[model samples]
Target: MKLKFDGFILALLFFIVLAYFFPQLHRWENGEVLAWITSIGVSLIFFFYGLKLSFKQIKEGLSNWRLHVFVQLATFLLFPLLVLPFYPLISSEIQHDFWLSFFFLAALPSTVSSSVVMVSIARGNVPAAIFNASISGLIGVVITPLWMQLFVDFGQIEVLGDVYWGLVKEILIPVILGLLIQPLLGKWAARYGKPLSLFDRSIILLIVYGSFAESFDSGVFETVGVKYMVMVLVVVIILFVVIYALIYLLSKSVFKFNRADTITALFCGSKKSLTHGSVFGKFLFVNSSSAGLYFLPLMLFHAFQILVVTIIAQRYNKSFEEAEK
Candidate 1:
């Protein structure tokens, strides 16, 4: 099986390097323009997300209660549990921020497009993948912040109030507006899914650039250093492997899920959303100049998940094709 290179991953890397060299652009006029641009882009991204969701699809996929429950639990609960143990062990503010980054990764939703696409490639339960992946984002809008609230403080402004309010304005309202108008535009949105997805990626790239630019401007990386980044990558890989294995064993052995459901659960359960990471990081770490530091682990995890899962999905597809032949 041939492994395909993801241009998106390369684009993410490119943006980070660009941010390093041209960090000034994001901070032009104290970053007001860049911040305004990303904020609008973030809302539109979720608006398009809402537009693409199908109630019929969600209803159809809900029948498989076991698979749905397993995926959600693994996403919101199991992933966070793995990282929670390390919270108390943090020795300094810097160490705490690094831990928060991984925890943020754990708390994110499963990415919708890639999870569904990978599952489809592997001959998994595609409808269920779509349902789980779609609903995961909506759930994360509420759950992710609550998870973060357990550890994060928003400084002077009331923590829960400001966080939830920002979420309402940035994510929930746009999504609801999209859902409300879906009857008129849902078909249009579906017809143009590719462009919408491209738009999503473009906004994500902008956010990454703005974030890293902030980090570079503040010299946050100087304190965090390359050693910690290497550590973050190692931890991200270990986290993915462990979550993937647990989902595999539980779905196949404990639950006796069929091949398709097992594949869907494995892929969807092990994934995290970089899109949400970028948007939510803007709000979650708003008080910290080191916000980009928090996004670093998530970006690493995002790239790693895509590369590893695509390889596994291709192997699954090849095996299925051989069996058919």
Candidate 2:
């Protein structure tokens, strides 16, 4: 197995184990310090990485209107459109908060780092992936809130009104600053990108642990039983399959992109960004128990997307090797 997958699985297992055994450690009051540290620290790291991106790259990416449109459609439009109709079918016994959270996950944008990595792995359009991924993050700041307003009642959450500004200041501004500094740090960024990405990924794992630890501490897990867990797992699987299949068909028929580009679209387009999901969840839900529940689908989707797309990417890699032979 790839080291990325291994690292993710290990991090997940560690969090689950921590939540199970160290109940006190997971408590919000007890863990608040760690949580804040992880949140602020990760946000800063995210900003620095963003600073390394160039405005010229963003402009060039925008110029690839076809790829941008297709990725956006698959992420913001198609996924949510598929998910909304099913909300009625889900049993009312399930927490409204959890349902809303799931919907939020569906509405978020494609991931930045992983999507680009997957695109590169599958030998797809790297520049296009960078463009689409960054643009998707920017668009999500606007689109996610609008979707929430239309579908969910935000009155319960105090942070809803200022969430976008928080994202802009915490996430977007940092990213923009990073891009601006790209001219000076471009070489340094290129040299250290891998290490920086690893650092970013580690911070994300901590965020996941902190979020879940908070949920466990708040008795959220006790409220959700085996049935709820099973339902969530099923929903996650269905979401992945439907999105993957839809993107595959669209890539073939409409986009007429090459095989590698199609794979990139399928992976990047079908998956949501965990980094954005975690940060936004923190901003939107704040100390609410539902924030953890809301981020559940995103966590599940991240693992599932990587596993599924890794297999697909490997297969694509093999096929390319065979074609050359």
Candidate 3:
């Protein structure tokens, strides 16, 4: 018999279960310490990311106006609008939590690494993919919160006033610091990639555990159950397919984008970053007890999109190879 552990997702579930049954384990008065630790972890993750980024590549990608415009609009505008109409359909608090999860997925920016990887695999515009994927994270910092504020009241959030400073302290400043010091440390950071990855994933898991622990302690997860989980999974899968198809058609049939640009547009536009989702959640849901619920759709979308997109990119790659042969 063979058993496989899917690492982060499994770890996420374990921590969630642990927190649920043994909430005391994480409810230490040191909750503030954990928050600060998680904050520092987030900053470090973005910092190292900044270290590895290349501005020269981003500059070259700016020339493609059509590609940039469509990808950005798809990410920021089109994605969220896809879920807005469903507002009427959600009635219960559990239902609303799921809706917020869906909205959270849409509101997020394109992921950096996976977006670029898939585009490269599909023989896409790699430079533009890199550009859009990189910029999307930065842009989401401002746009996602503003979008959330459209529905949720700001007065209720205590950490929001610290929002800008928190963003700077936790995200932008560290990213900038890493960028500035990249010439010196980028190589070292890149060299020990495995450990860095282990470090990154560990912090993310901590954040997940901490967030969900809080939710569990406060009795937030009790309202939602396995049926809602199934609903979310289905919704996430549908969201990925619909968005991917819409972008593909618009890129090829309407915009007349060439093969490479189409691949870039498709991959970059269709995906959401869970990294940014977790980091952004810390700030956005600080005063709200439903913070963990907001992460559910992100976790769902992240897993589903990777599974679906990998198959699609592989098929796309195969087509190009067969044509050449």
Candidate 4:
């Protein structure tokens, strides 16, 4: 019997420790140099995504309008709405920080790599997962700030607009170029799935390192008490359960998707991207005093989602085994 550990989770922990102990590696006003590198890496990851996915797969995934729409709605609309009612909990300054983090978690995009990998592990519709996860980030680029604007004033139209333009140049351009060249390089990219996965996870690892380094250097966790931490953890776990249950029910009863696609919708719809959360936090709270706390909920949710999704994926995998037997 063998146990599978999530290397990314371990790496995130390592990065947190590295940030706390040696902040110099990833500490900068915006983690400026690494941010540029991460941007380029993100673009390359999408480029490879384009290269590997056949145009037919892309077209089919996009045209699955029902699945795509349902998943996106759950991600952008449903998740935030679920968290909104708890706004009253932010009465105190401490609680206000938690709320900001929670709302940020709610507004983040679906994580691309883990969502797709978990969908694959659960033997779900991989193409659909890829499409939903990829598009989720693009949607978040627009929707996340809008959600934040409703709750708190960003106070700078120029900064907000700059984030959008950055996404267009850095993320959208690479994906489009990759799609354009997919016919030429798709087979080659497909052949190297393992390496491409490493590339993807590495980008995430760097982002985690950078985000936490910024947080730690600023002493973001100094005011956070054990009680506050525990409460936030509980809230995050409950949030995951509610979202997962809702997505599962909708997939079966409402959407009537098959087993594979149900898994895709369940996983993708429930995930919140730490990558985009980190990026948004850097810009949204760049000069704010509590900038560090902004990503705390997102960090917590990232860990919680990985644990729950892995368990669910394993259960699904076991069921498949029994069916085969």
Candidate 5:
């Protein structure tokens, strides 16, 4: 079987390059326009997210409580705990920011589309994957912030208040509105899932462009040497490998899950969402001048997870075919 490159990953890299070359465009009227665009885009993305989520499917998925428990624990608890041990290594403000990036990646929710797609490809429990993936974002809205709050000094209580308020206004409210109307428009949203997804990606791309553009303009990359970048890449790979292996062992040996459940656990439990990472960064690091640095590990992890999971999914596919033969 041949390996296929994901188009969105390529597009992600392209926007970073574009931002490096044309950081000026993002500064139109001191970035007010781009900020407005991203702010609105974040709300709409979550709105459509709620609009498409099938509560019936979620209800069906709840029967597998063990699978749901494992996936959610791996996402919210295990990932952050693994990274928390490294916090003592921070010696300076820069190192603190870098460490925070890794923690942020660990704290994020799993990707809904990619997780479900990979599980389906690997012949896993697709409904369970869908349920876990869909619910992870809502869980993250509360959990991710609480995790960050433990470490992040959001200036004052007022600033922290503003962050939660922004989250509610931008993410929660829109999602609630969408859910309220989901009965009326859920089918319509599901019908145009592809286009809505495209719209979602477009908003993310715009956020990426604007973010990197600001960082580039502020000379953030000048401080980050190639050695540091290479280190980040290596650490990202290690993080993925460790989490993947741990989940695999737990699902198979401890939980005694079947092949389908094992695959769902591995894929959903190990994945992280760049979508939530992008939107959450806008709020979490709202005061930071070099906010793009925070997203760097997330973007890297996003690409790496997609590439690695696709290969694993294809191998599982091949194995299933051979067993049937």
Candidate 6:
């Protein structure tokens, strides 16, 4: 019923159906053109995100440094650390690239849009949520590539020379530019944040469609059977539950953040940024065919996270209501 569920499902279904009928749509004769479009689009989105961020909100969030630190640590450090040991558990066929992509998904930053949306839905601190989510995106640009370099070799990826700089140029620089101009746009962004958010969501939907369209067009599914798909889904579900449980326990025992802050941290810390994942995929993995495969886990994770977090946010809202009564 909610837009979160209905919109995502409809978008995904439309992508798949479109891919089935219009597989040729994915073929781009010029690689540079596609790269430029994706880069420019992502840069603009990050710029707008920075424009919406309020320095006053970030200062307030910084006052609760402990919660922010814990959430960031869990997102950037703990999640990847947990996935590292499981590399031995995956089969060799998916090892070199496929599994590496999955780990890359894990290592990505938290979702800036959805994290704040979920927190707001659950009646958590919106300003704090925005601060944490934005900061996480900035932090991830460095942390993600560094993590990859440490665990996986990029020898197979021909675009290795440009990958790091591409991330900085395409992702980080635009975001910085946005933040710099926040004062100019902050008032307008505040007034029309909802519409701008809708625009952001639409861009994400387009990226999703583009990624899946390429995958289906390239016959990636033929190489990976239903069994592998099932395995990945199971892993996604398990990883989601494990991270959710870990955050819950930590929030209750060690962190001792209030209910709202805990909810904010749990939602923000446990989710991955699909937007960042797709943009990074285009930038870092230039091999179009391989990039499509790499994006599969990210797409799956995005859908899974929204579904699970929607339910959790609803339940959290109910719990808060009961507590107030």
Q: Give the TM-score of each candidate.
A: 0.96, 0.89, 0.92, 0.87, 0.95, 0.89
Candidate lDDT scores, in order, read 0.89, 0.76, 0.82, 0.80, 0.90, 0.76
- Tens-place lDDT digits, model 2, residues 10-115: 6766876675566564465766876677767666776776766787777777766777789899999998888788677666644576678778888899988778
**Which one wins by TM-score: 1 or 2?**
1
Model 6 ranges with Cα > 4 A deviation: 1-4, 23-25, 95-98, 151-153, 156-161
Give a tens-digit lDDT track for model 4, residues 115-150: 999999889998899889888887887898778877
Q: What are the clashing pairs of model 4?
A: none
Query: Which is the leading candidate under lDDT?
Result: 5
For candidate 5, write residues 138-169 as lDDT tens digits.
88888898899888877754544777788888
Superposition error at 163 for model 4 (Å): 1.4
How many clashing residue pairs appear in each of the predictions shown? 0, 5, 0, 0, 0, 0
Candidate 5 collision pairs: none
Distance from true location, Cα of 144 in model 1, Å: 0.8
lDDT, candidate 4, at 134: 81
The TM-score measured for candidate 3 stands at 0.92
Model 5 scores worst on lDDT over the 10 consecutive residues at 155-164
* Native-to-model Cα distance after best TM-score fit, residue 17 in candidate 6, in Å: 4.0
